[model samples]
Target chain A: MARASGEAVLTRAVRILAVFEPDRAEAGVAEIARLTGLHIATTSRLVAQLVELGLLSRLPSGRVGVGMRLWELGQRASPTLSLREAAMPFLEDLHAAIGHHVQLGVLDGTEVIFLERLSAPGSVVNFTRIAGRLPLHASSSGLVLLAHGSHDLQERVLASPLERLTPATVTDPRELRSLLARVRRDGVVITEGHIHPEATGAATPVRDRHGTVVAALGAVLPNDGRAGGVVAALRAAAHGIARAHTARTSDSH
Target chain B: MARASGEAVLTRAVRILAVFEPDRAEAGVAEIARLTGLHIATTSRLVAQLVELGLLSRLPSGRVGVGMRLWELGQRASPTLSLREAAMPFLEDLHAAIGHHVQLGVLDGTEVIFLERLSAPGSVVNFTRIAGRLPLHASSSGLVLLAHGSHDLQERVLASPLERLTPATVTDPRELRSLLARVRRDGVVITEGHIHPEATGAATPVRDRHGTVVAALGAVLPNDGRAGGVVAALRAAAHGIARAHTARTSDSH
Candidate 1:
């Protein structure tokens, strides 16, 4: 058989890897072929190649799952490493003090992608998980990121239909634009029941040495009137994260 | 030009990704070509394709670094996810109580690969990082894992030359065998200055529902006379992690 183009093969490999989600981490060649819409033979060949490279592993049950080597390589030089490292101590502190869920998020395209999350047993309900994504208008982290984002990003998000995750989610473009302005002016956002009725998300922008927003430090708390104290705590943690990131970046260089 | 074999191309892609390290995250095409020993044209083409696949990203400085998508995908369905998640809360509590470096590690091949580490400012000197590795004989986590590892794995590792990382590192095969026996009997191991003179590592095994040692919960602390407290703390945390993992696994299944 003729070899596929290198680019096409790599793209297909990515598709194969992407099919393994948290809930469905293992798949047989047939399942992979069905998921990726490739022929069974092609899927078998690709899965074998991936297994050879340690990007996928065969389970004892003969199914394949994401390999540890892939996780190692992805983590060894992850772009979010420095930020996550810097933010972790502070996130832990905030999580301990607030006894809820604390997280760090960054803007990826028009959505907010969480880099880290710390949760306690019986903490407030949190919809966001590590490596999870949320719409720009529906999450407080996304709101903080969008508020400090570039003009192009702001326009792109504004032009797109805002997904309303809950009744409190701001779906109107004009209201969102003004809310973003307030986030910029006030430097913090508190969304009550924006993503879930039982939870509240409060976030503030974390800046770098150049004063550019690099991430959002947020907390998910019970939808109680206790958000007043959380905003101050979130701001403090965000400030600490920014300073820590700057120091870490300087040390690395 | 003829396209490379799919297997060769994937191997080359793995090599390219492996070249980026925590300290040296970004590299230009020339440097990547030099590092991977690939033709400059081939390196450039593969890099461009990786960028398109979002496995690598081009920085504003024109150098490339591991992309956000790579981190996201690696974390989404990592084999370590369930273990890490189950251990995180316990690790945090231990970190808070000990005010030192708390980590979770699993035996990967002949080495111990840390899946998570929590460190405090001005904490004890620790040589490990998230996704970092240490030899089986020179780390407390490694010793704990090796103690309960498969007989074949144990024999192979023992037969291999054990590099002495420090004066305290047990390099004598007979002595190491006895030490492993002690670890198995005691359910914990402590290494004083095995990897760093200023620090000590103490670890205990975390078991799954089947009572298999799945991970090691450890702490890096000052090499003072305080290992007693740390050992108790490590055991407690390991027990908590194992129970949490059992619960989580059952829930997921």
Candidate 2:
């Protein structure tokens, strides 16, 4: 019974945390209770415990926000952080060369979650943010991931109703399937106005030592005649990142 | 009874999470159970629950590591993320100009925890990593924060035994107190061989709208005559980050 209750409490905690989105970083006990559908007293007790553990912090406004300890814990050992650290040098090089937005993304569920994004001032307007999600059928990074993902994942995405973000997003399953095939064959992808009319995304796969595609390295640039250069840069950076990641992981073992 | 058990579970969960440090990113259940001092059965049960919630993931090596979902949740709403986002562009600029290491750090307890670090290839050796911590009297960023910290915090740090990372590290409370006074007056701090012999750290305080110091922007470069240029660039970038942070927080409200 104690074990069951503990699991239930963890589920509740996760639910409460899920509500604190990028835009809404803090909330009161009552607001959290409402959002998580837990009793006010229970929410208060759990929140107090979380604050004591340094997983949540009390804000000046008498609300609570995610704590620095939580971020530290997540960053210290998250596999994503390892991948991100390995790719960051190459990402910076690509960012300097391309002079726009460079990102590293991985497939999460059916969406692509960006792990890191390096942007320059007055660069192309990009909708993607660090830790932001984009649809698999509607982003260059997403397309590359979807094309290389497992068959079950691909079928599940193709069977669902694809949300069209702009005129250029591949909404039709048939067209998206062909696009995936081409991306797999070419090992790179460029999507003009897929997410935004003013931006173009080009991505390539980053692989592990076993030749498994692990992440997507992409650049978002202006929708101009500059994609040819971007693709070559991305491919080279991806290879560099893959080599570095392999070296890093192997060194640890 | 349920509430008390739930809180205990959360504490245990945090203890388990805390064991995954930079050098040890993944661990077997038996190792975790031993490290956390929980029964093997309890640890296995809790780890299973954590995996179900996506807070931990199972690796092909049959070990558990910090999950990508945990990193996403931490990055999405942590207050540190806002400060990091605000300072990133300026940090990048400083990195490019300095051609070494640039970082943003905030006080966590008596230590300073780096929120972000931009490093270049073949740059000067830096001991600090993103999410890494350094003693308040042994790092330039830490000294700047310590100099501007509250009286209670200052007293606590002074009362404790100051760790000596290098021969030049400030160990005498009287000397450290004087150094703190100088940092507060000059609004910047430079430490030579405090943590490492071949590296120098220069930092300036980053403030919010109310003029309260919230972070320290610093650069780790070679302990050479180039310290003058780095100090000027760090001061400029710190001001830029402060202004950007104030603007971003105000715009949100």
Candidate 3:
């Protein structure tokens, strides 16, 4: 097939990869073609080339999955290394205290991409995994981060449709704005039954030395109708991570 | 400037990224060009494209480092996701008890690439990092994995040049062979001063339900002449992770 340039092919390859989600780990050629909006033949050819280079692995049934080499390279030089490293100790402490799912999330474009997650074996039912993404209106971490996000980002998100995961999720822009206002004023967010009917989310903003909100540290707990010191724990951990990150930033300089 | 295909460009991008070490986060265009064996102009062009794609970021001094987007994508669809997830809780327990540098490593070809690490603030001086690589003969995790690795793979490493990192590092093939044999027999490896003079590493193999060696669970401790129950802790944790991974594997099916 004729193409524009090498760069265009690379971009197409990236788009093809973007089709696979956290839940869908493997995909057949036809499914990939349909999802990526590329011709099946082109998709097949690209998948072959990527598999050849170990950027993707072929399953026994010939479907493709993300390659270990790709993951290795990503880990080798990830930009979020500093923040993830800084928050990990605190995430551990929080997970120990809460005995639930503790997550560290950062604002990635318009989504809150979880950087790290510490989970207990039989804790709250949280579908959030490391590197998982959640909408700005359906998670407490998202709300805390979005509250401190840029004005343009806020307006852009408010302009878009907010999908609801549960009936308790705030989908109305006006209501979401008010919720964000509360998060900004209170320095923490407690969203009940947002992602799951039985779970509640609490999050606090993590900041840098200059007091710039860098990430949201959060935990998913049983919706027992009480904050149960989770707010205090998250805020304290956020503060600890912020101070650590700030010190690390200064050390790097 | 010219190239073979778009795939070649992706290959070149990976090569450029391969120049960075965990200790060295950022590099100048000239250094990257020299290390990647590409013309400076071509290297600059590729760097610009990568930066635009958010796979690499530019530093204040015009150097480039790994980008956050690249890291996020890597984590989102990594091959080691399940193993890392399954081992996290047990790794935390081991870390809490020992309070050193607890790491999870998987064998990638002849190298042991760390998948996750939990480090205490003033723990041992460990060179191993999350996503960092260690030679198959230079770390305890590497030794444990190599001990259980395929015969062909083991032969290949033993036949190659065995680089020495410290005085205690066994470079003689016969000695290494014996050491590996001991690891296999004892079900663990304790490497003293292999990576550093002051650090001792202990590691054990973690197997999946199908009895495949999936990962190495290990820790770096002070080389203070006593294993100090660290070995027991690691083995217990490794056993726990293996069972957890097996359960997850069964559940997924």
Candidate 4:
């Protein structure tokens, strides 16, 4: 057996855990080793350790899967869940007021990870998945988060590969840089980008007490060009969320 | 510093992470050591290892807090997040139909941990928090889970202390035992327990394809003495969630 540093142990544990995504829930030890590029013996040993800790569990059929213990720990640490709880009443109002797809998202590694979404019956179809990722340059919430993100983060994202989900997606780094600047000035983003060719979305940044952008609240409408009202509603909802966050924090302390 | 076994190291790591709950998000090294009953040196070393792995992060004010990386990894492993995604549509429908608080919870340890909750404005005020825990003998979802839980789990919860949250809470072990039996045979739990005297909740078990209870779906309503309609709606919604879960798994595979 090979000896690993304490840091290596933690990193390997995280890598092993990351192999289970929304699309892929279960995997065999050999598959995990291949996916994580760890030696088979090292992978198996670490996995057995995790199973012992109750962070992972093996099914009777022999495939290893994420255990309920991991889920419980994650649920405990989820700020997204807390934010959703705080914003639910306001989100419900926004959803009813807008009568479209209402979503809340936060920036995660240059992508927008949706925290909550409310859609009406017979609303436009959306590809966004809960706990799923979307390109920062393509979605409305992503645009808002990217615009408010730090300069270094913006540059890092621009330097990375920008996947074009639709023909209208802005893949040019320079162009996206300027667009983000305009979004910062306007405090809103109205996009008809890659997600739904026949749909448009308006997003606004939800801020904290120090005026830092924490998340984005947005609404998606059909691409028939009636977006001004939806944009106003989204901005109001975002402002309300910021106010609620401030109030809750102040009261808690 | 004292050395720990591989299993001990993993358990210690989990204990360190568990110290940062929703209420206590940040703490210093000494505080964590005191909370977990570990030596200061050992706690500091473990915290450093976790920070290096991005599971914990150092705040600007010098306190340690749970990191976004931890949140990301946890989100990946969360079965509740996946189930919530599948059940959101149905939950929304049920909430709309009933105009009340619709919630989803799962068994965690000896308590019921709320996974997701959807409530409209003017709904009954209940003290259920997302990711918060309630005793198995008190909450409606808790009862449903306890009824369907393994025999060991039942014995463990029964043998432990059952705190009474309200006058109506079933703290008597004998009574709780009979209630669990009734819950299993009836397939639903309608109770005015633990939360409020004015609120009644009806919960039903959500089964996976294997017919094992994976979760409990319930609705909280004002106890205006109308329980029959709410009970029927909760059972239907639970069935809907189970069907959706099966469909989602089949589609993913």
Top candidate by TM-score: 1
lDDT of 1 by residue, B1-253 (tens): 6658888899999999999888789999999999999999999999999999999999999999999888877888998898999999999899989999999999989999999999998998898999999998899999999999999999998999999888889999999999999999999888888988888999999999999999989899899967878788888889999999999999988
Error of 4 at B8 (Å): 3.0
lDDT of 2 by residue, B33-98 (tens): 999999898899999988899889989988999987788888888887778888988887788787
lDDT by residue (tens digit), candidate 3, B1-253:
4545767877887788777666678899999999889989879988888887877889888899987766766678777788888999899899999989999999987999999999998998999888888998989999989999999999999999999899999999999999999999998888889999999999999998888888899899999977657888888999999998888878878
Worst 10 residues of 2 chain B by lDDT: B1-10
| TM-score of every prediction relative to native | 0.98, 0.95, 0.94, 0.88
What are the per-candidate TM-scores when only chain A is compared?
A: 0.97, 0.95, 0.93, 0.87
Task: Name the runs in model 1 displaced over 4 angstroms.
Answer: none
* lDDT (10s digit) by residue, model 4, range B122-238: 788876766778778888999999999999999998998888878989988899999999999999989974567888988999999899999999889888778768777778888
What lDDT tens digits, residue by residue, belong to model 3 across residues A1-253?
4544656666777787676666788899999999989989888888988887777889898888988777877787676788889888888898898788899998988989898998887887997888888898789999988999999999999999999899999999999999989999999989889999999999989998888998999899999987657888888899899989998889988
Each prediction's whole-model lDDT (CA) = 0.92, 0.90, 0.86, 0.82
Strongest candidate by DockQ: 1
Q: Is candidate 1 or candidate 3 better by lDDT?
A: 1
- Per model, kept true contacts as a fraction are 0.75, 0.75, 0.61, 0.40
Task: Score candidate 1 by TM-score against the native.
Answer: 0.98
TM-score of chain B of each: 0.98, 0.96, 0.92, 0.87
Off by over 4 Å in 3: A1-4, A59-61, B1-3, B19-21, B27-31, B57-64
Q: What CAPRI-style quality would you assign to candidate 2?
A: medium
Cα deviation of B135, candidate 1, in Å: 0.9
Off by more than 4 A, model 2: A1-4, A224-226, B1-4
Candidate 4 lDDT by residue in tens digits, A1-253: 5446555777788899989886677789999999999989889988999887767888786878887677666566565555776677678778878788888899977889887788765677676755667888899899999999888889899999888877878889999999999899999988874577887878899998899999998888887778877777788888888887787778777
**Can you list the residue pairs that collide in candidate 1?**
none
